[model samples]
Target: MRIPSTRTVPTRSRTAVVDSVWSDAKEFLTQFAQESRGATDTDRRLREVRSAIEATGTYRHTTEELTFGARLAWRNAERCIGRLYWNSMTVRDLRHLHTADDIAEQCVEHLRTATNGGRVRPLITVFAPDRPGRPTARLLNEQLVRYADDPRSRQRTHLAQGLGWTRGDKDFDVLPLLTRTGRDDTPRFHELPSDAVLQVPLTHPQYPAFASLGLRWYAVPAICDMALRVGGVTYPTAPFNGWYMGTEIGARNLADTQRYNLLPTVAQLLGLDTSSDRTLWKDRALVELNLAVLHSYQQAGVTITDHHTESARFLTHIEREEQHGRTVAADWSWIVPPISASATPVFHRYYDPPNPHPHTAFVHHASAADTH
Candidate 1:
């Protein structure tokens, strides 16, 4: 019943390659003169970075390794620069050489070349004002102009965007307020961009599938469990039961339980009688089941945060359970059966330690004859 401990050697080689590519890109960017158009610099740098990255075998290995999230992160960073270049060109001073259409065309051409003659198109959508007073396109244009003229505009733009203030107006503040209050007021500026949406077809569809499966089945639950334990006490405004239901919370809970070997107090909190019979059992059972599943994950080493300590603890728990004469069910076996190659079963130990002893040995033996 002692579960074997396994070690996973962390792979830093891939990360090292990515760092090398980044260094090469920084060197390439330094060659560009300050007087040159920003768009031109961005375009040249993106192409150079991509080329350098591909040359280093990072991109190829990631693709082969099916590290879709990493690949997507790289692609998105390049795309963001490309989009920024276009936006800068459109709002550039007349003294600057390139036209908006010219810059846009250059972007499309670069994408096609990078993708090796793949179909690439830019789509544009419009953003309208929201109720309780929203900003107009004119106001947004003014803000864009202000941003274009200012030297510190890039930082400001990032801040504004992060705050959901894409278009400068009263609605920018309004949207954040509404979001904080959990009120969905169909705020303005939520619409798609005015220009075309750039569509990039992925090379392999199954790559995404693998990335999604890992996050949902493993990463997410662990993250949820951790976040809840660390931040739960302070944020008691909402019912802990409702909070636990969220994916983020669930993930944090799994992580915390695996790491600390402790179940969330929220489960016990939820188990308390809340006047209504329907509400009490439903809430309690949900929390307890989540805790049970997390325990199962820990025992199987599927979500163990620290292998050195946790693995030992898990094996000890398994051994104790076995000593108590518990049987492993098919659903709770940690080892994969030959019959079902794909199924990942949970490891669980069932035992009752507090039962009283049944027999009085002295009375049953010679002590009874002596008394007679």
Candidate 2:
């Protein structure tokens, strides 16, 4: 969630051994066993998983096991800054669904469920996983919903067009979902119902002219690029989401040169001197843009968090996890807010190394088109 920066994970190009699968399963199950206080038969479960992996080249996770693993994956995502509410995520077991039509519908359902009428909820929908020699489906879009005709979404936008999806004229147009059921299967485009997408039109709290820019963003940032790995099984189509952090929208998505690049426009509107970067015109505009994003989301009653608040919450999260004797891994460079680096509490502290932890999900690849 939080539409994290690029992260690379070991992709499952070929089947791994039983030992590899069991090792991850054991670590995950051991934690669950502790939570269960030995109520569940851990040893027996481990034996079954090992045997299943040996026989089928992959094992299955029960709904409970899957839910537990999904939660842990969110918890172990070191690049994410919004892990404070990781345990609140709901895991949808759509493993039985593999058809392009079925997976497409569930993805829409995921959007509706996560959107929650703008009170977005954290959720993940696990579709069919890659088998020994049979790979499952993958969503081509970086996110379930994104603006069309933007630099960030050009590749996917073109891909959708190639799939017979007509491009929209406006930059804020939502792209269709492209689902690939198998390696040989042609990707199908699925149009998202307009009701499922809740967008907040941006406006500055102070500047009336800012509203005319026609800037807005989708409410839910459901990321679909990351493959969900738990116990050696890889669910290539597991899409998960958390609410946005304000700076992610303002400082990165809107302000970054590669993204919407709205700073120059905001500066012009504010009548700031663009004659030189020495005037800090860009800095002033960046802050204003970030403010507008946070302000507009609040005005629209959508679920969003400001960087200052999220940073403090992340610190609180570290403290809470430490109390339970769990190591909360974090990448300091990724965790720190892009703006106001010195003001947040998270800026002063160090964290665990950004190593790949077992049972985690975030492996950003599509770069969140059109993100933030």
Candidate 3:
């Protein structure tokens, strides 16, 4: 929608139908009307919502409201540092589709649309939400697409294998999309076609042999398995994506102890002294690895940001938000870059601690079992 603002969002309901749910919905609609600058008819919409709640157990969000709420969720995401472009994200309304097959198909489409031939775009595809009598469909992968056989994803890999999927003998195979229509439905797996999944192979700018390590990462990091809540409505299958920050691939995914643990390998390739931690071999290797990630994505014509630039943009986002009469909520540990945490401007300040409020639109963390 080009960020002009149009989103429809609904909530998962249990017992809040008559009392708490309506109260939460009222609070959200009020804020939405206030922020909408009186474009919305708060009184009329409230009446409609009140009627819907009395007749059914839930109220549906208008498409415009959904779009706005989705963007609001992005802005309110406490752990994210790239919220400056939250409003720019595309909200795909696929709420009508509730089957495992339909969701898998649109997920593939979501990847293609977000990838945008290496020019990654921020996007979210909201699938059918849970309702009173029926459960919602959900994607079972932590991400819509992930490299196969990575140590960190072995649990998911095994789950796919248990579902009668074969693992190809490739270093970085894209795992199949696992889905479940409801709590009782047996999960299904759909392999992602190659054209829909874009990947960048890692190569250092200076080291010619670095490419031999066969390091790679998918272009779009579509976070699946997270629950999207709007006005008390919970969408269990809302998948979203933003362009990668180099450290997400270089500092943590590839270099973490439990993951690929490639720093030691890169250190030897760089001829760094590895006798002890005092040698600072890991430090030298991390910098080069990060450099490689940034360089490779640039050369491949893909969207990626370095830790330094992103941190600066985050501070800008806060300034812009403050000017709009809003306080940007941030978590210090997440706002600070994992690599060179002290050098970034975000390192100099204390941000608002995690203060998530009800009656707010937000994307929330899901349990590990949610991936199943």
Candidate 4:
């Protein structure tokens, strides 16, 4: 099927109103400068910057502040059980980039770097934000690599199949990055080169026949649609990712019925009786599927965390944060693993009420596929 064209968004100025800019700048600088050495001098500089913002209706973050804020956002992520490594996140400042083409190239580069030849790394790349004359830039792909599901569409132009993978191929397809430079700009789609994406074909250690299933998945899950909010400034096109926890793929991505929904197929292949829930065929297939994911990633020399170990590590994270006198806010639904929820310790504990972290946070955007 040929890819559908998107409508151009009308351009509009986004300069912060004078009063709001003044308030946000003053609030942010006060908190930022208070934490740095030589507070008196930094406070004076803050006043000067605030005055400039009042006059110009905008301000730029210093490299130090940008780095701090980006890391803080990760630290503030309530749904992430992997925030134990939040401090280790690397920030790439690309705020100067204003074009979608440049952003797309950098995003591809991000995938390559984070892929790390199978050992993934946590990282984020900041892009330009909406300003007076510039409309916000955006990436249309949910992740750098995601499968497309529409089968009946007529438009088939690009890639080997002329569209995404056909349903008969188990629908393992790669989506091109679609983006627009600004609200007024025309959208364009760019296909990712094969060398840049690292995928692991799944197989079981005990069930050698599992290899015939032809199941595979990308190594890194780089989330690309969220806006990064730092010190009251919003960057609509910032893309970020942490290394995967196994269940994110095994239990959720591959097992979810709306997604690949391979449990019934696997059960049939394994010769298990699936006439009723009492047979526990679904449960048996789920265990094998997760095992295949973990084993395959290990065989491929990739980084992945088993849900059990990660759940324990999350407790350690909570303790460390508590020792530092910081409350660890978390959503119980997200903190618990998708499968074997009652089997993990995180399932039994009560956590601090979820609250916004002052320094950093990863916030969601509307579904990218819905935006067009």
lDDT of 4: 0.78
| Residue range with the least summed lDDT across 10 consecutive positions in model 1 | 222-231
For each candidate, C-alpha RMSD in Å?
27.7, 7.2, 7.5, 6.2
Which candidate number has the best TM-score?
3
> Judged by lDDT against the true structure, how good is candidate 1?
0.26
Candidate 1: stretches off by over 4 Å: 1-272, 275-282, 285-372
Q: In candidate 2, list every pair of residues with a backbone clash.
A: none
Q: Which one wins by lDDT: 1 or 3?
A: 3
Model 3 TM-score, all chains together: 0.93
Steric clash count of candidate 2: 0
lDDT tens digits, residues 126-155, model 2?
Answer: 998866555666788878988886688887
lDDT of 1 by residue, 1-372 (tens): 988778554458656766655553343243222212333545655565567555643221111111221221212221111111121111111111122233223323322322222121221111111212321111111111122112323343444456566554421121111111112222122222323222211111212222221211221110000000000011101000000112122333222443221223333333445456665544443344344434433433332122223323434544553685632122222222112223212123322322122110000112101111
After superposition of all CA atoms, the RMSD between model 2 and the true structure is 7.2
Sorted by lDDT (best first), the order is 3, 2, 4, 1
How many clashes (backbone atoms < 3 Å, residues ≥3 apart in a chain or on different chains) does model 1 have?
Answer: 22
TM-score of 1: 0.17
TM-score of each model, in listed order = 0.17, 0.91, 0.93, 0.86
Candidate 3 regions with alpha-carbon error over 4 angstroms? 1-17, 363-368
- Count clashing residue pairs per candidate: 22, 0, 14, 8
Candidate number with greatest lDDT: 3
